[model samples]
Target: MLGELAEKGVRVTVEAEELLKSREADLELIVKLIGLQKPLISKEDVESLLKPPELRPVEVVPAAAFAPLAKEFSSDIRLNHTLDVTGKSRTRGEVENFISYFRNRYERLSRMLRRNGTVQTDLADVRKRLNERVRVVVLISDKKETKKGNLLFEVEDMTGSFKVVVSQSRYNEKILDKARGVILDDVVAITGKVLEPYIIAEEIEWPDLPVVREKSRSENDVATAYLSDIHFGSRYFLEKKLQSFVEWLHGRGEARELAGKVKYLVIAGDVVDGIGVYPNQEKELLVKDIHQQYAMFDDFIASLPDYIEVIAAPGNHDAVRRGEPQPALGKDLVSSDITLVGNPSSLSLEGVKHLVYHGTSIDSMISSIPGTAYAHPEKVMVEYLKRRHLSPIYGGNLIIPENIDYMVIDEPPDVFHCGHVHKNGYVQYRNTLVINSGTFQDRTDFQVKQGHVPTPALVPVYEMKHGRLRTLDFNY
Candidate 1:
């Protein structure tokens, strides 16, 4: 009945009518009304009425229907016209009234900006510099109360350190109570004035960063292989092939170079088969449970030598934020050998600064640059170094903090490693050796569906001696 009325250019109301009883009665009435209102009723309008709503409707008419009407109405009318109050031009008068209201509001803002010099303030260099404030999320380590009731907080980031002083006297008593409860490693955002070099925090906000368990360190020449995004819970996870790779690392025929030399192992992220990941994803999952998926990963990491240092950084598929440059898992979950670090982390490997970032964005960048993406992911990584960002854009697959500097290379790194696209590549960037370690898992359902044939590869070992580096690829 509603569809029939909609087709005949009749306004649909909530109350049911007695004239439209069944489909046959509505169809007859609709045909009659269409003939009478031929100027208003269109075939396309009837088709739209018959088709089901794209999204489920509620008690009220869906908002989607009004969007097109609103757009059309807005386009035809200007928002600064004078109103014509006469009833002879009622339709035009109503549109003019709305336009007048919009124009009045805009003019009010314009007048305020002119009177207060807000527009000029934006252009003034001194005012711009004075208003230059950066909001930072810091993990408050230590806090002390000053004589004047100001709270001094010390915070640390990957790059360097800074201090935040909050004037406790200005805040309400309840706010002070909440501020006192701040704990160690509690991620908090501080907004304040930058006094030349230091930040004088005006306000503080809280965010959650899970407490991680710590692992013991080992003294050995043991090299740990760090790789991310295996997608093991998916049908793409090659258990047999991964098993062969691990066994080869342990000491298989003709592959003994990796046995004792590989003292550490890390699976950075995407260890599970996620639900609702993409279209037809449910059909591609081999293991569905996330906990069971981690258990499998634990078993795989455990199979490595006990002396090996195993660490993991959560990926988009992992039970953490699907952001770039994620932090390694804290000490809580896995064994001591397996340490979890942030997604993009820096470590001193044999006295060489090695920065690791899972190269997920390299695909888009590679595709954009001519003859870059397919030929070498490592070369693309070097491009990121030039930009000085681990992940540049805000919300593309990887989440990054507002004030955190992922690109600041204060001290040049000797080696850089990343893995996400499952393609193995290497390149020399300035003095840094950039490596994109290929995956150990064989191609799965996603690879087949997406038509991505990955190069199944073993680890590439890098040895630094006498200020020179030697890279060796060990195939299993």
Candidate 2:
């Protein structure tokens, strides 16, 4: 009945039907909704009579005209790997795959660390040498403090695992500090002396950022605006401020001059106030139905100027799997008009490669790294780039692993855009512009309790010509 209704311009989904059923609405109420003055009588007019005013029926459009910029610069925007594969491994195979993947990561960094003059020894070899000085690279499997207050680490290699001890008395302040900051699963080079069953560490080394940076600046005058976390249908959604931005894009106010130059808009994710996304979410939602929520989002996007091509990716709140390498929302939710891609996707806007990630793993990044915090998201972005992987630690965030590590930064992007922290941050790392686009939603009760001040309605526009960034404030 819903599919038949949709065919005649009435849009309905499982979510919408459930909401409607909850009301136990009569035909008269349904007729009034579709703006029909005539009474509901004939079966032929049933679909048109029940169609809601707000739900704009989906219209198919030619994809070529506004196809994602990724198509144009396919060579530059490389999807190194993805987890969208069938026949995923069984329990034992999954464990083996995880171990093998990390082992490869360990070996790769180990070879890189070898240039630092650390004699590379396997975990098995380290066990052989008792009461002798040794240097080795290993993946930290586990770490704990003893009753004696010394940090003990169970590090492993392909050969085997060994216990590494950082004695409070023996190791100096510098070594202890590094040991304290050591993250589990992080492959590190350790220089130490072998004890009875443990290696007493002298120094710990991380695969830090490269000194020489490679930057890209476009010769073209085109610019792109980065945005995310719109959370449409939430009471906190900044409708007025966002409309002001759209007005600016349509050549209004001080931003009128920038309107012509801005050719692309990248939305990182959390595009809607998803149904049942959190506890007490219904109280916060202005639109309770998921289809209605997306309908509003679709209308909002449709209102934007056609000159600026919009590229969107899904986040945790989107109607997709809650895992890394999440696919785009279904066509039923999002029309073909938007260039929708998977989360953590890469594209190029006029020669400038952009890495668009929802940054759901930002929590993990902040917690795992000692100095990093939510307020300074770019610091975490820098850490991700330095490590050349997004969300390195597995258990921190929900992830569905594939044969290849899709999170690995095999190909570096010129512009990296992410959002989820709701705090805007921008920085340059090795020539790449790392930007946390922030949110369009106002501060909620949760944010207030957390003491997080979101930088809403501040759109970061990147001037591709000179690699310069200018922020446009629409709060006024």
Choose the strongest candidate by lDDT.
Answer: 2
After superposing candidate 1 on the true structure, give the runs of residues whose Cα lies further than 4 Å from its correct spot: 1-226, 255-258, 330-337, 464-476
- Candidate 2 wrong stretches, greater than 4 Å: 1-119, 129-134, 147-149, 169-171
Score every model by TM-score. 0.50, 0.76
lDDT of 1 by residue, 1-476 (tens): 65656655665323323223444545654665555555544445555555666986557753221111111211111111121111112222254544453233223322322332222211112223454676554445567778988767776543345776666664446556555544443345566676644567655654211123221222333344545566667776767767766665655534354344554454545656556666787787777776666777778877764545555556566665454445455343444454456666666544555666667667656654444654467777766665444543334344433222333333345667777777777776666667777775677765778777676655565533333223334343
Best by TM-score: 2
Error of 2 at 406 (Å): 1.8
Lowest lDDT 10-mer window, candidate 1? 77-86
Question: Which tens-of-lDDT digit does each residue in 399-442 have in candidate 2?
Answer: 76644555656457788899999999999887788999989999
Worst 10 residues of 2 by lDDT: 69-78
lDDT for 190 in candidate 1 is 61
Instruction: Please list the Cα RMSD from the true structure of every candidate, rounded to 1 decimal place.
Output: 32.4, 18.2
